[model samples]
Target chain A: MKNFWVTLGALVAVGLAVALACYRWHCDEPLHAAARQRDALAWLTAEYHLRPEQAAAIGRLHAAYALRCAEHCMAIGEARGAVAQAEREGRPASELAAARDRVAARERVCREAIELHLREVASQMSPEDGARYLGEFLPRVAAYRHEGAPTVRLNQ
Target chain B: MMNHTNDPFSEALADWRVNPPRDPSFRAGVWARVEALRREPWAAYVRRHALTSGLALLAVVAVGGWVGMRQAHARADRDRALLVQVYLSEIDSRLVATDGTP
Candidate 1:
């Protein structure tokens, strides 16, 4: 009887986990922007006879955007490194601040480019699809909720 | 309502429309391909079996750990409660004995 109860308890625990996962994923309430992008691409190709060249071109532009973002990310890293070096040498972190400004400038450019790309995408996609894409990305820039919290929300 | 014909996906797709990119002849160069895609589609890359299995394994281990912690807590509480009950019973008997002596 004790063993039977233990087994029953285990089953119940597993059931609760499954329920939690279902609730968290929202039973399909969650949006799939990636899947939507693929669909849009396929539809564009099939509907408009968009040459592979054209599709590839847009893909390239996106790639350029990614590189720019990466550069900004790298700049931020370099700036932080400079600050660490300064601290070790008992010097002011003024050099780090200058590096930070460089990163900030690069990031600003990346943001403008992202906006331009978004404008192009909005012009190409349906209103609903545009909404879904924006919904996925805009939350990445949300302000901090608490101290020491990591702020990456591309899943929204 | 449970039939496939009434699926929500159907409704979503039915309302779908497209606005083709203005420049259809554009082609991404080698650099773009290397940097952006870096691999296959993002979905394909992320859906690797290794990653999926790793995440599932981590989740299972976490649940097991949580369950172990809860059982330990329950055991500790049970032991504490039993000790308190035994102490109270002994005190009650001594009080009865003293009442008779008085």
Candidate 2:
């Protein structure tokens, strides 16, 4: 009976070790690799199978657009703030409408800029991939609410 | 010469006899009990053949773990793809800074 218990315990331990190993190597490995990547550029290069030159070109475009994007973000923030302030102060209907229009206009401009930037990035890829990239991204830009950075929901 | 018919004690001894009660299934009952005793209980069997039982259990565990690993790997591949998409979107939008800036 004692020997039986010992053997049962050992088997249980072996089962646990096997489970842990599977989780680490198979379940967690890919996410870990994704985490180890430097940024989106690396992800793009890998996913799209971009040539080195293509990746380099896209990288330059991204760097230049980043500054413009920040400026747009600030402008949009200010526009939203104006709308908020107007609402808080119980401003005239016309004043509130104007503030709201300003926010919408700023968001429109930001979306247009993003669309153009995406086009430029896509142009750096191969023809088929470029079209696919645009197809994937254009609708997202159009639908963006400017609430925060867009994210892909993994669970979905 | 001493065993003559006139001895009453000898006559009584000769008349003494016994008749047991009848049991038709007694033989069958006894054989059934014998079979039960011959069969080994499962726990004792396993204990007696510990090495073989352990090896069988290990094999089962190994196969189950392998299948689980395959499923996990497939799921991870999908998650990796989604993560790549998220990374690109987060960078391109710039509404929320990846660098923790406003």
Candidate 3:
């Protein structure tokens, strides 16, 4: 009986070892590393295989774009507030329409600026990498709903 | 006892003798029965069927490893997609608009 239990325990240990080995073998190490990274720029640099100069250029572009995006966000927020205020005050249809249009216009400005910035960043990579990068991101930009930060919807 | 040998009954009793048929394998047969009745230990039974037991263990380990690999791969893919989404959201603000109305 003791021998049987020992053999059973040995088999279980072997199975566990095999399972752990297989899990480690199949896990995507690079992707896991990228997921652990908190910095988007660092992730992008590693994922896209960007050179030092390219990373620096994209970094600068990102900084500049971030400021522009913040400004656009502020403008869009104000426009939306105006639209809400118009509604609350029972303003004329024309005034409400104008406020809504301002919000839409701000959103369009922000979207187009982001699209341009993405293109600029892509241009810094090798032609093939740039095209690949654009392929991955351009659709998200086109599909932006101005709800918040853009996300890749896996279901879609 | 002095004159009983002359009597008929005493003569028959004196002539009586016992005889039985011989079996050459009788002792061997009894030993075979003893061996058949003996209980075998579980460990010994497994050792006796080692090939079958080893094959079963191998199959179990293989299936377990395959399942582990598939689950790990699926989880990794999900994490990768989530990380990509997070990275995109960090860079692009349009998807997360503050206002409910776009």
Candidate 4:
């Protein structure tokens, strides 16, 4: 019986040691996010030859833009939901068309705001670099903009 | 009873009973040897197996570091992909110019 207790205690101590090691080394979400953010800024700096100040400014702009985007996305989602609901209920053609038009108008507004924001970002770079960056970057964002509409419950 | 002295097994038993002259500490000596064998400290045991232990530790650290690096790399890739999406959200000027007036 005493041997059994001793063996059990030894096993428990070893288990605790391994658990502590894992806790010390494991990555958490916020740290991971921060690292990625740093990597993205680094990528921009390398790609555009951005000065330190430009990198900082662009990073801040992106952060703010992300917040604005969330808001715009939420609004767009609501408009899309209304359109979907109208269609599902077999509303009159005119009402459905009006809902569709409302979504389109809101989308146009979102697009304009986005373009203005891009211009602000580009202002930090040389004219050639800015134009090239915008040309390359805009299309990727556009691809996903409408991709999620069908799958996502945008209203929520 | 046949003549007891004539039986070889009886004679041998009688001789052993008369000459029971062995070490009484035999059992104690055996146990002491076992304790000596089992009482080494863990540090000493590890030192004795240093090469094997070091290799095992190295293997663990190498594998753990690799997994951590892969996870970090994957996370950065995902974030970069997201940044591309964010930048693209600006939409092509052509689309903005041709689509509905805001």
Candidate 5:
């Protein structure tokens, strides 16, 4: 009886610890949002030379990229869930393999889509604007903006 | 060749040991510089830049804060990634130990 109680207490403690651990580790929302914000600023800075219409188009492209990322995550979830289900039911190996392959294909498609979007963003910009991108825009939109930190003076 | 050389090493040693300059102006110049430095506090000279110590300190603190924030973010990124990796690895290890990797 004592061993049973001890084991029960340990399990409860461990379960609570795990719950807290997951809560603490959950940085997905904030980190990903920060990345998206930087990406938006990058787009904004890169298209200063372009017409507003062109800039608006890039904004549309950003919205699409966000959607694609969500789709990619969903695909991974679907694949992982199917695999888990297959393991539970002792399902056939080929079926599991196919699910994994489908997820892999979706992942590739997402990467290609992003690359193509970058190409479009670049092609729409003037050469000078493009250079500004390489020289300044890429460095400034960081969380800390290291490369563009203005020089400091004592009086001002 | 003069074979009767009187200990050339000793002569060379004596030549090197000769006393330094007898004129006192050199020491006076050093004292003069010391007097000049004493007459002018560094704050006056440094004031040309119009930089107050407090302002300099604030600037340092501000830049330091920015740098610290950047470092913290980088460390947070690394630590976050490591946390995810460790969590995944723990799950993997438990599954492997339980023979549940199928």
Candidate 6:
């Protein structure tokens, strides 16, 4: 009976340890977005065979671009909120139209920021890699994302 | 039958077999001692089966480690696929057609 308990305890301990190990294998929901960006950057660096210096520079560029992207996204979100509020209050059509225009402008800014980031990343690579990045890789990446939006709809 | 009157060893053996210990509680005392010896300590029980238990523990660790590693590898592959899905969605037809053209 004592041996049974001891063996059972050991088995439970091992089961918990294995469970924890498996849990760590997944990127958490909030971390998933960041992981995707990091993995994408890592893939690019590896595929291009970038030098340390080039990678570092491109990393900085990516960071800057991310900041700009965030700012644009925030603006778009704020405009959408304002539009919703205006609609709720039964505001003038002109006011809603202006809010819609504001949202559109922010979206355009975000797209341009993404484009500049791509250009900067490509420029940091070797000429051959840069051309392929701009031509093949960037196109494939864009086509999959549907006009540079995230997989999940931001508004929805 | 050849009877020898000078055989003292046989006589002593017969006497000892016929005349046992005179203590009234001798059998009870012997049984008590036997019971005490029969009860084993917990540590002794573990020591006796240490080899088997150790082998079982080793097997558990090996199987757990293998399963954990396999699960982690599978999750990593799935994560990589998701990252690729996110990345490749941005590509356009024109950009793909112009491979390596600056």
Candidate 6: where is the Cα deviation over 4 Å?
A: A1-38, A136-156, B1-81, B84-102
Chain A TM-scores, candidates in order? 0.45, 0.73, 0.78, 0.62, 0.44, 0.61
Shift of residue B93 alpha carbon in model 6, Å:
23
Candidate 3 TM-score, C-alpha based: 0.68
Give the best candidate by lDDT.
3
Worst 10 residues of 2 chain A by lDDT: A146-155
Worst 10 residues of 3 chain A by lDDT: A146-155
lDDT of 3 by residue, B1-102 (tens): 278856999889889997878999999999996675355566775787699779969987998799789989887766656665776666555544466344
lDDT of model 2, residue B93: 39
Alpha-carbon error at A5 in model 5, in Å?
A: 70
True contacts kept of each: 0.00, 0.24, 0.45, 0.02, 0.00, 0.15
lDDT tens digits by residue: candidate 4, A31-135? 345335545556666657788999899988878877777667666777777888887889999998998888778777777767677778888987888998778
Which is the leading candidate under TM-score? 3
Displacement of the residue B2 alpha carbon in candidate 3, Å = 73
| Deviating ranges (above 4 Å) for candidate 3 | A1-8, A145-156, B1-47, B100-102
For model 2 the local lDDT of residue A95 reads 100
Ranking the candidates on DockQ from highest down gives: 3, 2, 4, 6, 5, 1
DockQ of candidate 4 against the true complex: 0.08
Which lDDT tens digits does candidate 6 get at residues A1-156? 665566668766986686567556542433344344646656666657788899899888866765666566556677777777878889999998998787667656656656667788889999999987778545544443443343443222
**Chain B TM-score list for all models:** 0.44, 0.42, 0.55, 0.53, 0.41, 0.48
* lDDT per residue (tens digit) for residues B5-65 in model 6: 6689878766775656699898999999777645655556567778877777677777776
DockQ of each: 0.01, 0.15, 0.23, 0.08, 0.01, 0.07
Q: lDDT score, residue A135, model 1? A: 55
TM-score, candidate 4, is 0.43
